[model samples]
Target: MPNNSNENSPPKVSRQILRFLVIGGSSVAIDGICYALITTWSGISPDVAKGISYVCGMLFGFWGNKVWTFESTKRSVSEPIFYVLIYACTLGLNVGINRAVLLLAGDEFRLLGFFLATGTTTVANFVGMKFLAFREQLPADSTTSAPSSEPPEVAIPVSDRRAA
Candidate 1:
């Protein structure tokens, strides 16, 4: 049988990915604006400025991804810890890539370096958060139910039953 409803609807994974991308776009904007502001107004180095902006972006990203992107309700103590660890990796990647670009070619183009670095981490962040960080936790009710102890009643065919 053809599933017309399914044909009209996008796959769940695709929808989640789309939502994630939307959230990421906003995070990037936040990150870029803050990076520009901090670098423009302060004496801080680009690397340091970017670091601060990146963390701010991550904070927004975390909330957006948790509340809207993934639609997760149950909270686990370990998830936040895990999220921090994953962002730690992402932070290193973003900072390292941006600094490397600035050192090599984008010194005059700070935003360019920022974009290049942000591009590098976007997918990793999504995958990590989708699969690990904010994945839904199912309670026992949502999974297999507890087994029942009662035995099933059996009926015998009239032809097979004896006098009884």
Candidate 2:
């Protein structure tokens, strides 16, 4: 189990990083497979296929990071809205990177361009998701109460005490 306290501390940060990496790997697989299937099976423009795959990946990324990576349970009417904001920013950056890479690398290396775009956007997404969008909140019970570090005192029943 990862420590939920001190997210900035080395150990907890490392845990978060590890969990983020796991979720990132899953998102990559989902995006890659969906993109391939959509492009191969459908006659739609590659841009359209890419957009659909990106949306699917974005939704999965949001849910996976919220529940598993951050274990976030904080509730607010604006959370989804905040998520949209992050999505838009990251998506725009990703698209920009893709176009730039394609232009620089040439169409013959399209796959490389795609990978570069994905890699850059993924790093940005992780940073935003970790620090802003779904920042971890302390467990609900932690706010109102504090647990003692000392061992808890337990009262023995009268009969058990006599036996001793």
Best by TM-score: 2
Candidate 1 lDDT score relative to the true structure: 0.81
Model 1, span 1-164: residue lDDT tens: 43335321458668878888988889889999999999999999999999999989878988888888888786788667777888789889999989988888857978988988887787788788877888755455432456658674589889888955
- Cα error, candidate 1, residue 2 (Å): 24
Predict model 2's lDDT versus the native: 0.79
> Which residue runs does candidate 1 get wrong by more than 4 Å?
1-10, 90-123, 145-164
- TM per model? 0.59, 0.60
| Model 1 quality (TM-score) | 0.59
lDDT of 2 by residue, 1-164 (tens): 64455657888677877898887788778988999999999998999999899778877877887888877887775556777787789789988888887888788878887888888877887788777888766554564357878786789999899877
Name the candidate that leads on lDDT: 1
